[model samples]
Target: MHDPEHGDGTSLADRPHRRRAVDNQRRSAASADQVHRAMVAVRERTPTGWHAAARQHIDGALHAFEVEPVSGCIDAVACLIPPRCGFCGWRVQVGTYRIGFAVYRDGGARVASFATAGDALGAAIRAVGKEIAGTAHR
Candidate 1:
């Protein structure tokens, strides 16, 4: 005779499964709307001078990175948004100067400056997405 329950009183199947992509390390959890908007920002392709073949290869890989299970990052775009701030490790702020917006990383060092908040945030999002995409493939 044998017991289905382990000595610890819990079975292996009783453990809660978690998505590796959205684990607490990825900012607790993001709402579906938040994830969708972030996906739009992540999927945007910035113009680059690459051969068509290379671009196609990269695009396919990116598509896989954005698919179900992972769905890319929930909020890879970090910004002190007017409504709410996205937490993506990187820090961002809309500045008060001739330059409108900027991103910061590694302890207050400025990453970039943009004429518009949207541009700054988009660039940051694209960068984060690119990094995640690269890791997802390799």
Candidate 2:
């Protein structure tokens, strides 16, 4: 496949953005797995005040709960921490310095800046969502 944007002989996966989106998906999946493990722990333990509080904010998987996304963000679980993708689980933080986004991990952003955060995020979500629907990716 030929990409007009990069006429040089480079494969699609070799492109920075092509690789980056994949990396974001990989990290997002990892975050989701981590959250699922924690949720499992919460389920198996003697329920405590702290566990109950954390679960209140998480509210389980995206389908397990309903949310009214007011902004580009998924929900209002305190902006200090970018809430999980819900489908997965900072997970893709948006900044206004010329408008950009990144995948958050290890308490920092992974620097996946794009030309427009909303467009790219929404497009990626819709595209990937359609493909991964009713499966583990959802």
Candidate 3:
């Protein structure tokens, strides 16, 4: 007997299973695309170099060697050192400089020079948070 619904001799019982399999494949593809977009967004928002390093140190991903208040420089100054590597230490110096605040990494690599130290610190913190959150999403 011909099954009008299926047209062919294929069992009615098999139709639902095939439909489900097709649906699952579509859903999986959509999920993968969403993940790729999220990763791209995170990459675009996150900063690189010493800013990133400083963020990692603040987030506890890298060990902090020292974070201390300084004198004879700016109104408010703080120096941070990441853990030593052999004999070399990575440092982040944030302080008021000239007309604004300046954040410098080791060897005078400037992460950013902003109107306020708060702005610089906020930028670093936001970058680190985005990185950590992005990994979690992945």
**Candidate that scores best on lDDT:** 3
Expressed as tens digits, the lDDT of each residue in 1-138 for candidate 3 is 345554666566877766666665564554344334333333443344322212223321333212222222213333332223232323334433323233444487455443322333344444334444544575
- Which is superior by lDDT, 1 or 3? 3
Off by over 4 Å in 3: 1-9, 45-138
Off by over 4 Å in 2: 1-14, 44-138
- Model 3 clash pairs are none
Q: State each model's CA lDDT, in order.
A: 0.35, 0.35, 0.38
Could you tell me the TM-score of candidate 1? 0.26
Q: What would the TM-score be for candidate 3 when compared with the true structure?
A: 0.27
**Candidate 2, 1-138: lDDT as tens digits:** 665554656676678776565667665555455444444333343122111112122322221111112333221211112234342232333223233333334456443322332322333343233333423353
> Global CA lDDT of candidate 1, please?
0.35
| lDDT at residue 75 of model 2 (Cα atoms) | 19
> Native-vs-model 2 lDDT?
0.35
Q: Which candidate's TM-score is highest?
A: 2
